[model samples]
Target chain A: MEQVYKRTKGIRDDMVSGFCPGCMHGTVFKLIGEVLEELDILEKTVTVQGVGCCGLAMEYVTYDCTTSPHGRACAVATGVKRTNPDRLVYTYQGDGDLASIGLAETMSAANRGENFTVIFVNNGIYGMTGGQMAPTTLIGMKATTAPAGRDPKVHGYPMHMCEILNQLTAPCYLERTSCNTPANVRKTKKAIKKAFQNQLDGKGFSMVEIVTSCPTNWGLDPMASLDFLEEKMLKEFPLGVIRDKSREEEAV
Target chain B: MARKFMKGCEAIAEAAVRSGCRFFAGYPITPQNEIPEYFARRLPEVGGVFVQGESEVASINMVYGAAQTGTRAMTSSSSCGISLKSEGISFCASARIPMVYCNVQRGGPGIGAIQPAQQDYFQATRASGNGGFRMLVFAPATVQEAVDMTYEAFDYAQRDRNPVLILADGVLGTIMEPVELPPMRPEEEVKALKEALSDWTLTGHRAEEKALILPGGWAGQEDRCRRNANMYETWGKDVQVEEYETEDAEVILTAYGICGRIARSAVRLLRKEGMKAGLIRPKTVSPYPYESFDRLNYGKVKAILSVEMSIPAQMVQDVELAVKDRCRIRTCLRSGGEIMSREDVLKAARELV
Candidate 1:
């Protein structure tokens, strides 16, 4: 018998993940694990996860990691990267964690160009706390908090993190990705790898924002959530690499 | 290093370097400003890193991250800044990361004043963060004491795998005095110290027993906090206090930080006046010297006077706990950046006698 594929060494073998069925966290986690294992930096990396679902990485990741206080993963990662420059460090954050409560830390880390990677999962809702409206929630989307759908006059518009970060001069890479399709999943993994590679190369802050689906919160099945994602979420958070210094010369 | 005259905050920073603190993250605030300033200039020279973070919350989180890597890390802030840092401090406690920090305390209760005030004693010893976690807090009365305590705090934090605090006031922070500084820790020694912590310190993914548990190594919140409570119980053996001339005295003067120093002087003045006055000063305010008060002969001591710069008398609550009302407790206090005067303490001791 020929073994084509097996589990990634990047995730712990003894533990089962707590991600909800149809949640993209499982898919994104698999991608990050595959990328870490492929790069062979599993033993050389330290991860800081912000509060919310992203914090689950602290339990399942094969590498040593810490779950910082809500919204401070970027600051914690900044500490790790600045002090242990030899160690590969990254932060996995949610939209609520990064854009809402931790905007100061995220913006400061990005502006300072701290040499680290950020895996931002923007699922348009705070999944861990029971589907509250998130900073990335679509204007017309109804969350637990915004029962009648997000009103622009009251709740404000969804934040485009990649574009916001693109305004900063220090970022080495800024990309928005998704996991709604196999090709998009591959691109998300590639974006994560590039973000990690930027850190290994001693480049400044790099962020790969993954526009994901939350089936339970979206009130739809996993497949239907993908349909809503492509039909709505993509329109607001368009997928693309907002900035890549590596392609500066080519673009110019 | 030889005895050198230096500002209290700057000397504390230098002492941290000598003690092998290789990482510092802090924000700018009064009195403690010299600490970040000194680190900003000196840390790079010693191959250490210094960051003037966007805020105290961010700065302490940075220290938390750095300390996870087995690095000797620290952060310092003033009263209101320390209030802002409480969130990160609680996080570090939750994670059980070893690090040191100092509060060159200013007036509090919503930025009450920028000058030194002893108003944060309750905040420091009671609820630095919400987790019921305890830190070994050192109350230094002089520049020399501040330098010495800051120097030794790192080793204590590393040994217990807990955070330690140097509680100083603006007067101690701004005063220039000569200190017999400790010898500079060798770079190799610092490296080895960090390496020795590799068993627990975050160093990337390791397939080992330590790597198996959740971060902070607890089963749940109750289990985590209960374990820390157990560790704190053992710290009863580590309480440090200075009891002076209390064998047989009619009045016992008790205080901490600058107020303690003033109380000591008041003792001298009371002695010169032929009044039987003694002093009980707690060097470690957290593991407070409760036993010191137990050792006092209540039959001989008629009154215990609590002197502090906090108007409502924060540390006096501890003094009462220490005395347990066996002796009458009195307080001579100042607040909002007003340093307690030896004369006021002297008069209060005379009244108590």
Candidate 2:
């Protein structure tokens, strides 16, 4: 063997990740890094991360990184992209950061068709804040805020972000994928890469919602959490492409 | 390069472009709506970007993002809109990103009025945002001053890697005057300016390199805050004040923005009556021209009249601090969107002299 296989150069070797053990954020970060390295955009990319466990991507990502207030990552990334139209800009936000407090910014940016990418990590709970109820928490899911279980009458149903964004004419790409099984992990990586490529092509707004797991927040083992993501979360938020206007742009 | 009649808001928009500002993101509001409207039609002509953001909150953060790339970016809003931008301004301050913004102020405490008023003096000079951070506030008295101060505000922002504010009022924002516009910056010069700040900007760097922009969320922030305090101290030398006819005066008048311009007219009228009167106007309100008071001939000066277009007067506190109670201090006040007249200032100066 020529020993050609190695770690992606898009990630920092000396940096210590701040994510908890068995957190799916590490896997998502690696997928992003591998994609950036393969696409040769690691040097020109700027990452704006929200305030959460996913926001810790600033420490591990090799690109220039910025931190936004809890839910303003999309707004901040919009600033970065509009100001420096030449550079590649993206934001990594958690479920609570993207779909809850930041819902206004998320929708507005998508409507404007901002030329950037958003990597939304949907882990069903707020991992950083001790598993608080997220907008994406299942109808029966339990959280610190929802002590017993989520009730649709009071708590409201989980937000389907990709489906909501798909209806917008501005966004050129919108996809939902999971990181549970090896096959699904491969698909998630591909979706992330496609989103980045859409921005590079100047096709306007793109987003990749990765259905992830939080072992500690969910109070389950790492393997059990992956099973839960596949069995329950996948049923509600089906994994597939919801919108792909990029294909139309290609034909033009 | 051209001398043309223009509204204060329109003149500021042109000056920002001439100063190499390539990014403008703003939302529309009364008194300041001309700023964004002007930029929308003008920035693209100069190879710049202009975005009418969804709201004041979004517009300011967009400026924050653009500024990190080492470009001159800015936004403009009125009193209430500025309240929404406070959070974004705090983030820019903590991150040490250089950007400029303008507040064409209106009467306020909460949607008080849309007309001209200087009620925001306390808000602009004192507590702009959540942090202990202070912005170098420029209070322009005329459309000419508005053009000049706005052109230089960008440099002040880049010098300290912080935010600078041009605090005008609705009177200055909507009124028209003739201004000699500065020369438009060449495209190459704009690129050079951005390149000059590359060492600290968030532009893509190699894997081994690090860009330290945290935006108010960071570890070991105590040390970073102390560094900011040291920078604030140096602003004493950067203070700008215009002194007119202060030599051998019996009474001095202190004001800022349009109030300063109105008081200047009052000074001329008082001097004609053979009453010794002078004017001390601050161009930068944050690093206030406290030294101008020290230069006054205390032996000849009897009283200092603080004139402003606000209720119960807010700038009196600063004037008192500068005077140190060396002489009598009186405030000529107006509010509820009322413009302070030259006659009122003359009346106040007559009582003191």
Q: Which candidate number maximizes TM-score? A: 1
Query: Which residue pairs in candidate 1 collide?
Result: none
Winning model by DockQ: 2
DockQ of 1: 0.66
Q: What's model 2's lDDT at B164?
A: 96
Q: How would you encode candidate 2's per-residue C-alpha lDDT over A42-91 as one tens digit per residue?
A: 88899988888876777778889988877888888888887677788899
DockQ of each: 0.66, 0.71
Query: lDDT by residue for model 2 over B32-131, one digit each (tens)?
Result: 9999999999999988899888888888888988898898999999999999999989898888888999999998879879999998898898888887
Residue-wise C-alpha lDDT for candidate 1, range B1-353, written one tens digit per residue? 56799999999999999999999999999988999999999999999999989999999999999998899999999999999999888877877888999998888789889988998998899999886799999999889999889999999999888899999999999999999999999999999999998777777656553232233432577888888899898898878888999888889999898888989988988888898899999999999999999998888889999998887888888888888779899999888977788888887777775
Best by lDDT: 2
Q: Fill in the DockQ of model 2.
A: 0.71
- Per-candidate clashes come to 0, 0
- What CAPRI grade goes to candidate 1? medium
